[model samples]
Target chain A: MERLNRKERVAAILKILSDNPNKVISLSFFQENFSMARSTLSEDVTILKKVVEDIGVGSVETVAGPTGGVRFVPSLREEDRQSFLKELCESLKNKDRIMPGGFLYTNDLIFSPEITNKLGIIFASYFRDKEPDYVLTVETKGIPIAMMTARYLNVPLVIVRRENKGAEGPTVSINYVSGSKRQIQTMSLPKRAVKKGSKVVFIDDFMRAGGTAKGIIKLMEEFESKVVGVGVFIEAKTEKKLVQDYISLLILNNVDEEREIIDVKLKNN
Target chain B: MERLNRKERVAAILKILSDNPNKVISLSFFQENFSMARSTLSEDVTILKKVVEDIGVGSVETVAGPTGGVRFVPSLREEDRQSFLKELCESLKNKDRIMPGGFLYTNDLIFSPEITNKLGIIFASYFRDKEPDYVLTVETKGIPIAMMTARYLNVPLVIVRRENKGAEGPTVSINYVSGSKRQIQTMSLPKRAVKKGSKVVFIDDFMRAGGTAKGIIKLMEEFESKVVGVGVFIEAKTEKKLVQDYISLLILNNVDEEREIIDVKLKNN
Candidate 1:
């Protein structure tokens, strides 16, 4: 490859780092690929660090010593985060979203790539400090957001299935009570999904009574792993929650089916 | 924000464009945010286009008209895509991934964020020209990759569920035979998930006899939508497939459970 000038070098470097979020790239990689001196590449990285921060999209961090390199840590600006959540809440307030039994229809929003991508960045910002080995979620509704969180954190995503499949080989299945439905539900995972003594963060689309969150805690224990953090897109107001200490972007106060009204608000706004 | 010089402007533009893949950003956006003149921002974008292409990451395109703007079209270099698929085939060759019933235990790999992110980019590259309105997939395993594909294409992801949920409101459910198992199965989707005359691309993790893909086509027909493209991570060797004209990354020849061997190879390599 031909050597690039400072302008080209900075753009190339930023693109590579942003592509592999939170995963460090050795200095030698840039040196070998761009055929530039160490000092020159260092200057390009320093310039990139300021450029990214100036844009308020993320930060480019430089690690020190052996095995150290630079990585891009994605984050949303505080005001941007708040306004995004506000807009999300407004979207959820549509009366048409209220279904039978007062259930809120959120598949269109939660399954959106653009929204989930931002949600992933926000969730990663909150849990990245925990240095989780994996991002975990139950199958179906939560996979998209959890997958995004895992991508931003540069970690593998482990999905717990609703039922054990023959394709999963030997599995660990556990029955837990659903706080909202008050019924026994089963969740399963492959035995080799996570390493023992590893840390994982749980991400989901909704939290109603927090029964699923509590069940996740028990499921992690069976693997000798830990759930260090939990994040949800929406949390319904209930008299009592099965678990506490979880972050939610939106709060669902009421979904009146007969009245044809939906009331949702941004959490902590 | 203060005016940034050429190097800083180039970096910022690339970062923003990459963040919102396939979404056009008007020049006024940069003019307002970076406090730059139109000519200056245009020059920076020209340089960024060459830099990204030279690095073999993707291309930056400028749309000309009243609502003209620039957008990033992401693509993996041919060699990189081939090598990535080769490594994936190698990973699948692990004997431990074989289950008792000749099923491959691929939950770990298919659920991986890094792997699926790349797979999404590749799928988007192939189908982007179709200008899909939505990227569709079945529940459980296909959500992650489909979400990524939708992200890269800047479209909403629509997931088909195995069973209808009350929260989805009125849904359209259909029963189809599992091509491999030869048993009847059901798939459901919200009635409003797709607009009439919209084009969609189907993505999934594996295809045994293409029964599910065929089911997607029939389901889309109910909404008056069209299935423009189909992509999968792996395609198992079958006597005959139920669908044709689809792209697959890998081909599975055989899984010898008794001999503890797995035979897989890159598709069209």
Candidate 2:
């Protein structure tokens, strides 16, 4: 809800595209949509190209005369992604972000196409060479970024639902310990939802105990496929345990069910 | 999932903007993501500007000089929107789009953000002026465009569920006849989910017998809110019904229940 400054705005915009990983937008197209002065946007574009490159997940390139604008290509280093996600985890602990079930409420950011799109782009850049066969996300909220990122990657999305739809198919389902609740919960994905030997990117709106992520990892393995990477819209590791090779956009620092003093952080690359 | 030609691609992108009423994109920013050569993108921008104007629901203008690009501000004439929707209905009955359930399957367009975004933009352009307080849709698939349009209008989204959730307070429940069977089915939304005096835009992924949309409309009125407009990702209206005042992005015409022939028509305007 806070207004983004020029620097943040540019970062945010680029982040949206990077996060999008779906359809790429022409720079001129963006200039038209955002309605900023051409020179200002040009300057911002220049800065974004540099920042994204420095971050190491990707590079934003400006296409030349006649038909080109800027397009972010995947060029990220794995270390950078890890560090960036680490920073993200730190920013998610804000008291305001605490929700029921010890979940870090990142509704504000996940619901934001701008922010979510950038996250998509970042992943796109991070995983470009890998080329995952599909994207996986769970029910309710994760659908946004999962759908957005799938668009960027040009792949189909398979959703894991807590309940099965008789219409979808008979399925392989799992009941896992939900970290936030420390209670086991059931979720399922259709057997045909994903194919074997294909590369996949696993993502979700939030990752606490990593139970769902791990469950999905196993489910994906059932297809005999490889997990190219894991990304979370927000990470609350301090509130729980985490595994390696996962990306978290934001993190939670401290919490108080009573006073609710909170701190938030973003993974720094 | 299908490849887009130049004109279709351009139209699709513009449609995304128009789909969300208050959404905007910077032209330069757009150019960067698509990897388009500037000149070609410029021309595409020009065409988008012109065609959208002709549609009368909005105007696409250029912010010139070093930083400027095109921006679409919806000022669409109501008559233009209505007639465009009318023609859309006629085309939907075509044979190419038929699927099971007298329903017109528009999965082709719905699956493409390029198309959905544009449709969202067009609908937003028309509905933003209506000053709707919230965008409504039934759960599962309908959530995407609903979220997109809500973001465009900078409003909250309230989703209806076929069943009640524990987190939601006492719910306002209603029933309507579904095509799945002539038998009536129940639907619900939280008691505090919507505010009174709010203007609502009803959105759905599919509209068959107009069951879900009508149920949603009734639910809103129970909250003392008005159903300002109804829009569907896909519409299969054979005969104009009392509920046809709303609009649809794609129309499904003539249905062959036995043989299964569905036709699709996109908005001609």
Candidate 3:
């Protein structure tokens, strides 16, 4: 194989690193692939890191150790994040999106790949340092964003199904009260879905009183795993929250059922 | 902005294109972003396309004329695809994945971002030319794969919930029989999830008798949309299929319940 020039090497390194986000690629891996010396590869890494940080696309962190290497951490510009969230808030304010029972219709917004992808990047960037073993979410609406977050973090996504079907083999089911509705709801997960003592991040589309989020925390406890962080795309403002210490991209202020109005704004955080 | 060298330019182009797969990016847009001439941008794209194709990472297609530009279509090497699908078959062969009603446990596999991402790339590559308006699936287990396919195709994911909730606003409901058990089931989609006259691709985690796929086709009809393609990660071999003409990566031949054996193989296609 012909040795690649610095320019070609840099381009190839960026492609490989970005594709496998948050994954550490050893210096030797790049060295052997590019047929370059350690010193040369180090120089390449420096240039790539500087360029990436300068461009505000992402950051490349180099770990110092025998087994350590460079890892790409994706990040969106603050300006870009604000603008994207503002646009999302706008799109979510349509009158027709107001459903019955003071619920706001956000399925389309949550399911749109373009919107979900950007949200994933934002959420992943926030939780990058957590280094979760998996991104967890209950089945249904939240899977898209949760999957994207897992993608960017280069981790597995474990979904806690609403009900375990026979196909799941043996499952662990738990009944939790919906904090908002105060109704008992059951959520289940296959025993093998998650490993014990693993660290996980919980993500979902909406958080109302954090009943489901609380349920997820308890569920993770059953697996002997720890929920490192909880993130939601939208969190409704309530008189009280069952679970605090969570992050939400957007805050829903109020829903006027009679007027068919929804008030949504980007969270200050 | 400072001028970036050929190496930096190529790296940036690859990142942007790969991130927005199956979407045509106009050259002028790249030119403006990179502050490069049309000729320079064209050369950069050429280098990217060649490198991508040579490495079997993906393809960069250039469309000429007024509305012409470059599009990145993701692909996996034949060797990579075969190995991945084979490993998946091995993991899925566990007898524990079999349910009492001859159903197979696949929620974990489908929910795992690592496996789902690879499957998404494969499905996206197959339907890249289909130019789907949306990627559709019934809710729950299928959401992850459908979301992934939607991500790769750069389209919105429209999920058909098993039951319509008050939060969905107005929904279109349809009754269909579960082919395997001959039980009637209802699937519903929010009225505004899709647009009329749109083309869509249906993706799911499993297909026993293709009843759900048929239900999706009927649902799309209600929306006045067309299902351009159907893709499933696994399909069980049955005496008869409710719907044909769908692509499946793996085929489940049989599950001997008494012997606790499960048989799975990769689809030749």
Candidate 4:
């Protein structure tokens, strides 16, 4: 490898840290790769930290001790978050998105890689203090956002299946009432999925009565794990929620099928 | 904003490009953000490109013409790809992973964000030339990897459901036999999900007999879209496959429940 100047070195360091968000890359690893002195690498890290802060994307923190290293903590700028949430609300307000049963067709939005990636970072930022061991979500709609959150947090993603399949070995199935449908539904997970006493964050695309979130709480109990946090993209207006203390990016006030009006806005706006 | 030196400017530019993989960012956008001369910004990009190449992660590509811009094209170095796939095969070969009915339990591996993130980048590298309009997968296991691939490709992810729900508005449903189970199953996708004449790539965790892949091909036909490529993490040994010309990372020879042994290896190794 050729000798790289400070400009090139900073760019390389940022790229590596950004790729492995929340995962520490040892200083020795960088030193071995770049063939730079410890002090020089430290100076480069300081410069990189300042650059990331100036850009308002996130911050680079240095850990102390034997395993100490540098990590990139991702964050969305305040103004960027506001504008993004507003634009998302505007998109959801499109009348065509309202279906026959007043369900908003959010498949395109939720499945969008760009949108979910940002939402994941937002969710990660909110739950980073919890130091979650895993990010959990049910099958289908929530998986993308949950997967993104896990990626940003540098944790594994655990998906609870709607039903038990023969291939998953021994499984634990739990029955929970659907908040909106008022019907009993079964959700299952492989017995080996979550570790005992692990802390997990639940993330999903929508929440109506928070029944699923509650269900997750009960399911986590089977493995002796804890649901430290919950997050969703949209929370629909409901008379009551089964669970509380969850972050939602958007609130859906109402979807008027008759008038073809959909009222959605950023949460707490 | 404070004026940034060359090192800081290079770090910021690299961060932006890395975050928006494969999505072109105009030179003017960088110029406006950095408040620097176009020539100077170009020099930073050039330095960043050389730095990325030195690191062997990927390349910074420059597009020409009126819509010209720079984009990050992520790639896994050949050695890294080989070692990662090899490690993945070893993990799968654990005798405990063999469940009843000769099924190998893979939820932990497929659901892992770190593993799936790398798999996504590898898949993106393979299908980037296709310029896929969307990365498509069925509900459940494949969503994580598919989402990652879409993120890396800078495209939308479209998930097909096993059953149609009222929330998706109008949907097109089709029945395809499960290659391994040899049972017919249904898959449905909303009409608005895919655009006409667009190209898409199908990604999944496992492929046996390729029935699901064949079904995806048929389903895409309903929307007048083309299935340009297929990629999977594992492919089981079978008499034959329903579809041809797909990429599989690992080849699963057998899962011996009686002997508690699993035989899996890297594809074409």
Candidate 5:
């Protein structure tokens, strides 16, 4: 084994911890990799913890005692978060993004991995306290952000499809009225997707009346799982909502077809 | 400002580099943040570059000359890749994964952020030399994997939808035959998704006859862009394929519906 210096050891430790975020990494693992003493490894951790905090990108927390080690929890500074949201809102204000029938052309934004990954980290930071067992999303548009959130949380992502293809194995389907169009729609989940009593956090790209959010709650009930929280990238301002008490990163105040304008900004929550 | 020691500086540098993979970071940025001299930062980078390679998780490369510094490229060792694929194939061999048709239920696996994130790094490593401008995928099942790949590659993800939704702005739609069902289907992309003369990579969860891959090639041509490569998580073994030049992580030989058997293994490539 090569004897690594303090700089090399700290770099290796940071890489390992960042690679496996939210997972406890024991000092022995570092000791084995770097051929370092426990006390040296502890000093490296201390340095890492302080630097991470000062940077405001994330943090390293000590678990304490036996069977506990260090965990990396990713986070964004408040100013950084605000600036990102501001940039997103500015991009979304493009007149071309306003489609007919009050729909905002957010497909590009939602598909952009860089933006979605940041949004996922923000969502994950908010729910890190909840320690969700799984991140759930209705299929198609929401999968990217939901997958990132699940990645940060170190959990599986369960996607409920708008239609059930037999390839998903046995499934449970549900019907819910579309909150915006008031049209009846169906959603389905595979039988083996989630375990009973699993704590799930629902994530979606857009919430327009919260009908889909309400439907997900019912869908989770079929699996005997609980939805501890709901998070959406963009929630439209609505007079009535089928579901309430959800976190939204951005709010769509209005989409004026005649004026070709979209009013979107970061939510106060 | 607190003066960071060598260990603290190295840890902070590693975290920043890992967080923004493939993006060049100047030494001045580190110097400004860590309050370290240029020579010290350079030495730290050299140490990090070697340790990252020694670990086989990834590597840090120093870009020479002015306006350049360091870049982190994530990679997986052959042994780690083989073991991960072996475990994945084993889990896929579950009897319940076989559906009524020859389809193997892989929704849960593809939806898994951890698995998908790993797969993304593998795919990104393969195509990093190509320097793809965009990663593309069709809507529904392939979003999670594509999103992760795009994230690792540090590029935007452009999703082609199965149908023309007006919300996508003006889109260019194309007709292609589904390789499995032999049914004619429509796929569309917004006009603004990709720029002309851009390089693109197509990613998907599964490949039946490579029809979708072929369609993506044709769709990219519509934007005057080129499809540089196609990557699929699982490729069904077939004598005839619509597209031949592509990469697949796993080869799914056959699915015996009656016997409830699925033969899947990691591809040699």
Candidate 6:
């Protein structure tokens, strides 16, 4: 195996901390596994502390107690976190990643290390920024992106099933208009999935009419938690007013099924 | 703007070449634009030549005439290309990136800079292996990833539409079973979109039934081209056998709508 450099080593360490959320690990644990010296490990951790501040709600708290060593408490600047995530969205904005209907292909981007790495960084950044209690999205397609986002944020991403999730018992549902369906569809979020006052970021793959995003907004109201922000792969710019404080990698302004014209451009990071 | 290292500089040059698909730029143009010395420019060109080769295409080439400096012929290796993309995929696989329904959120991953660097590297690696002749996908959701894949391979992504595109004249469409609908839906491709004998890599956000992939397959058949492979973000394993010879980053096997049981695991690169 190849040895890691200081930066790669530090990145790896922070990633490790970020991975095992809500846990404190001894610096010695990393030192032993990496076969790195204590001083070097300490320096690595220091670098991690500094870099993570830019992108992760991530902090390395050194514990002097018997059980404490270093604990990562997610926290970071929203600008830094947004910048961190903007990179992933931009990469997906590449024309090559563009799929039909001017959609940005999250499936392919997630499979790529570069895109996924940014995904982790973005999530870690969010963890530092919003400390969202949970992640939220609509079903099927939104599942993957929401999972990834939640994983990074070290929170669970809950889905609002458009279709009945039989196991959730009698569910709470609301009807909202979908641009695709051009009508109302029943959208549901599990009761008690999120507590009141909890913060959340809503994520979905493609937002056309944004009926789904709005539905989730109503669902969040039921929990009394704030919708921290909204994120999407492809935003149908026509629905710009669907939500305030939203981010999208690519905005689909014009998609003509007859003309076959797809106008795609990068959105604010 | 900050000055870049040799690797980033070289990658930037390749991007310049690919973006100008319709025209060829002489070395002098690059030299004048970057304000670099001749020897440095030559070395950069050499590195770029190798990068194009690594992406599995000969699209980048050198013209011998005085007016000729360098050009991209767009040839590459398919297998190496997809593997190159593994880096981004692996990065996205971080548990932190998981949101809900075994889904991964990649908006930030696609937009961030440092993460985009990793994404660029992963994409370059995948393109080096994939060397596809054309990028393919269904409209709307798959665009971003497919566009990125198409870009790394230095090829144009041809979308298969589910509805008619008026500008393209009469569209060609086929019916296939959708895992989402469990019923046949009409899908299409432009008549002149792809040439015969072309090699294509099918890409999308999520794969449930493989029906969409199969639809792309049938659409490509209209042009008598071969479907090289399918790449996706999250594969609901239960829906496997929807298409053969496909790859994905995550596998979601146990989906229990009632219990909210969603098990996601990373796929081998």
Tens digits of per-residue lDDT for model 5, B1-269: 37777777777788889888888888788888787788888888888888888778788988888988888989898888899989999999999777766667787788888788899999999888888999999988888888888988999998888888677678899999988779999998889889999999999999989999999999988999998889999998987999989999999998887777788888988
What's the distance in Å from true for residue A31, model 3? Answer: 2.6
Per-residue lDDT of model 4, residues B37-113, tens digit only: 98898888889889888998899999998999999999989999999999998899888888878888888899888
Order of candidates by DockQ, top first? 4, 1, 5, 3, 2, 6
Query: How many clashes does the backbone of model 4 have?
Result: 0
Error of 4 at B214 (Å): 0.3
lDDT of the candidates, in the order given: 0.91, 0.63, 0.86, 0.92, 0.87, 0.60
Give each candidate's fraction of reference contacts reproduced.
0.76, 0.05, 0.68, 0.92, 0.81, 0.00
RMSD of each: 1.2, 10.7, 1.9, 1.1, 1.8, 11.1
Q: Which is the better candidate, 2 or 5, if ranked by lDDT?
A: 5
Clash pairs, model 5 backbone = none
Task: Please give, for residues A99-169, the per-residue lDDT of candidate 5 as tens digits.
Answer: 66777888778877778878888999998888889999987788888988898888888888888877767
Question: For residues B29-59, what per-residue lDDT tens digits would candidate 1 score against the true structure?
Answer: 9889988889988888889889988998889
Model 6: residues with Cα > 4 Å off, grouped in runs: A1-26, A47-128, A138-172, A178-185, A188-198, A204-212, A221-226, A231-269, B1-130, B133-172, B177-183, B188-198, B202-213, B223-225, B230-269
Given the true complex, what DockQ would model 1 score?
0.81
Q: TM-score, chain B only, every model?
A: 0.98, 0.61, 0.94, 0.98, 0.97, 0.63
Flag regions of model 4 displaced more than 4 Å. none
CAPRI rating of model 6? incorrect
User: What's the TM-score of every candidate structure?
Assistant: 0.98, 0.63, 0.95, 0.98, 0.96, 0.47
lDDT by residue for model 4 over A109-131, one digit each (tens)?
99999999999999999999999
Chain A TM-score across all models, in listed order: 0.98, 0.64, 0.95, 0.98, 0.97, 0.67
Model 1 compared with the native: what TM-score?
Answer: 0.98
All DockQ scores? 0.81, 0.10, 0.63, 0.86, 0.72, 0.05
